[model samples]
Target: MRSDPLIAVEHVSREVTDSTGTLTILHDIDVALPARQSTAIVGASGSGKSTLLAIIAGLDRPTRGTVRLDGVDLFALDEDARAAVRAQRLGFVFQSFQLLGHLSALENVMLPLELLGRGDARARATEMLGRVGLGARLHHHPRTLSGGEQQRVALARAFVVEPQVLLADEPTGSLDHATGETVMALMFEMNREAGTTLLLVTHDRGIAARCDRQLHIEAGRLKPAA
Candidate 1:
């Protein structure tokens, strides 16, 4: 069965002003993200891929246009409201593996569940860590884990919420090729099993090919890659 699109970006544009002048980062972008499918955004540096992803994911607002996620207009929501929506329906994995350095792997995953006021957070977190093949490393802090392991922990924390939408920014940006492939495969497998909509910004061609659709950014414009 086909499900409704989890995210929609319509004529979105982003611009920033610095001491030098105004810089247009993304120009007139449009895309649809259907549930249970993966889509990748690819481009070189300064292509505005990450900027567009940030706008679509509600981490940053667009200079113009609209973003709808799970039927909610993101721009209409206040910051706090948007945060609430994120907590309830969105999950994110970033290139930097933004885990708390002091928190154990399991505790990191449990944090999101706690935000949702869901009990059994520890149990669910442990299960998520195991799913990421980090069963024995659950008690380790982010600094103690390998780069790949930290990313996996980030993935676990994101998926622990079973979010309706998952946004990843260059998920494998820092890993070696083999480790990157492993982590990417795990991401796809979990997304498939959970039927979560995925929107990933990546420079890796192999990663892009695995997605259901591809959107490429060039000169601040979004286009279907030839």
Candidate 2:
């Protein structure tokens, strides 16, 4: 991992208004994740872990403060510009394995590359599917694959772009224990091989333990991990 931080969060906070009143979902948070390192964000349900992840990924905006990804101030850009940066530099893996059910594995993996206008989209997608051990299942739809297989396809699609950072939210939350373990193992293996910085939000202590560092959040404040 490089000495420089790949992601920087400075004095960040978030709030939402409900019928009751304004509620703070995150407090003044400061975090720095080094390049090519793995960090886990751990907290209980509704502790703002997911909220933080979304802000980091540029999927949502924080009410206050700034987020810099590889020296680029994310919120400084307009939505379209931010999206372009995300497509080029970030990969996301969701717990639910968000694949288009109507598309085959190959097609699903090809979508991003296609959107980016890569001429060799088919070849790259095919190669990625093979890496995830889904070479033979390229034509299979998500519904036909096992949960592990579906997640593997999701992994392939995420890494196919060779993103600088990989962000995951409860990646194994929906799987059985054994399958979740297997998927996580593959995730780490691929992370190592690709030298991608990994920032994952997970409630599982075992998963958090595998990361280089763990950030514990409680009541929207970043706390030292127990």
- TM-score of each model, in listed order: 0.96, 0.98
1-58 per-residue lDDT for model 2 (tens digits):
3566789998899999989999999999998988988999999999999999999999
Supply the global lDDT for candidate 2.
0.95
TM-score of 2: 0.98
Write model 1 residue lDDT over 1-226, tens digit each, in one string: 7566778898999999999999999889987788777899899998998888888878899999989987789999999998998898889999999999888999999999998999889999999999999999989999899999999999999999999889999999889989999999999999999989888999889899999999989989987658
Model 1 earns a TM-score of: 0.96
What is the Å distance of residue 199 in model 1 from its true position? 0.6
Candidate with maximal lDDT:
2
The C-alpha lDDT values of all candidates are 0.91, 0.95
